[model samples]
Target: MPVVFVARKGLTKLDEKFEADFWAKSLDNVVEVIGNPDCPQAADGLEVGRAYQFQEEQSFSVAKKGDDFAKCMEQLADMVGYHWRMAGADGPGPFRDLFRHPGQFGTIGPVTSAKLAAEFATWDECARAIGKRSFYAWFASMRRMFEYAKTDGGVWLQYE
Candidate 1:
């Protein structure tokens, strides 16, 4: 399955935020991509609506804006063979629920994003092992989302 990770400014009132006007303005930018945000490409088959986490979020294809990295792929495969098992020693990290347990959308607050981003900044093949070229792109995009959220806010994620 192909999933996307979006960085929206507002999360409290999405009903009003994603009005028809918004779609009209962003329709061109709203790419209907079908691929995993973490991986290079997902299964090449029918683009079913249920294949996505949110029908409304089918436009979130920003996570798919990068070339694949070999070191990142190797580390991810060794550390977490499956995305669902992509948690941390402490507890559930990012992308854990997206693969392991379906229907589990998680959030990373700005404070935590800051901490994680800072820590991930130093991640190599030896450390936490997810901050390579493409892997770091995920963190970079997420950090950009946190920028919109600021210190008290963050981004909501969904993958299934």
Candidate 2:
């Protein structure tokens, strides 16, 4: 599955909604941590625009202590719960939509508007980020559908 990048900001209520949605989907092999379980920089929270990577599975965390899943989870929680507090409704173009769908709605590896602004030099980079998300969503949805298509090693076509 392609990496899914989700940004949470400006919507406290929606953060809860995303949590509910993920749990309701009953995804297995995933753990959700609400706060910074491990303090990396001896700071209460990480710098606002930095990106941290971690494993999503328990086994991975156990094998790689340096991976720092806790920090990633904390950042995720902050995005969903607290980032919104600092956001102004009209401060910038995409800040307000952190909780909702920014004009471009897609999911892919951990890229966010803030990240884009910090690293990207031109509009092309931004477009590529959005494209990555769309590609990931399409790839995942199709993979799931294909998995469901084959049952008991037989392709049965049930016609109405």
Candidate 3:
């Protein structure tokens, strides 16, 4: 499926929600972490939450379909691999494997956003990396999305 990426300021509450949603996606009680079982990033008493914030926010834009996906990722496929359906084709990229994670809400924390922005920091640099200029607009938007999120300052990112 195609993905829509959005950025928002970090919120501890939002982190809670993501963790809740992450656990909810798993039909079982067990949840995996990167390494530490007791991931300190998660809040202590967080209730189940939804992507209510992502649906409510109207300030940003959603990039999807051929305009944002196929054509845009055409050149990007070489550096990141063929991702005709999603942002990251495989397990990792300069952007750390886009939306491949379950319950990452089509997006993630500012750290991941930083990883994305780092790849698309500049148009010339991005075009150089992906080898094209026509589809850099989406990358620009993706970069701006992270910049806005950085401006907001958050640990959680809302995705619709």
- For candidate 2, the lDDT comes to 0.28
Taking the tens digit of each residue's C-alpha lDDT, what string does model 3 give over 82-130? 4534554344555433434322333344454455567667444746565
RMSD of each: 10.6, 17.7, 9.0
TM-score of 2: 0.18
lDDT tens readout by residue for model 2, 1-160? 1122222222111222234456676543332322221212111122322222222211101112223323332332243344533555445533233323221222211233333233222333333354555333333332232232212110111111
Which candidate gets the maximum TM-score versus the true structure?
Answer: 3
Clashing pairs in 2: 3-108, 3-109, 10-84, 107-133
**Least accurate 10 contiguous residues by lDDT in model 2:** 150-159
Of candidates 3 and 2, the better by lDDT:
3
Q: TM-score per candidate, in order?
A: 0.36, 0.18, 0.48
Tens-digit lDDT string for candidate 1 (1-160): 3345554332232322333455565433232223343321121221211111222221233344223322333344455443324444335444332233221234443444455445344433333244455565644544355455434333344443
User: Candidate 1: where is the Cα deviation over 4 Å?
Assistant: 9-103, 124-136, 146-150, 158-160
Give the better candidate number (1 or 3) by TM-score. 3
Positional deviation of residue 29's Cα in model 2 after best superposition, in angstroms: 24
Best by lDDT: 3
TM-score-sorted candidate list, best first: 3, 1, 2
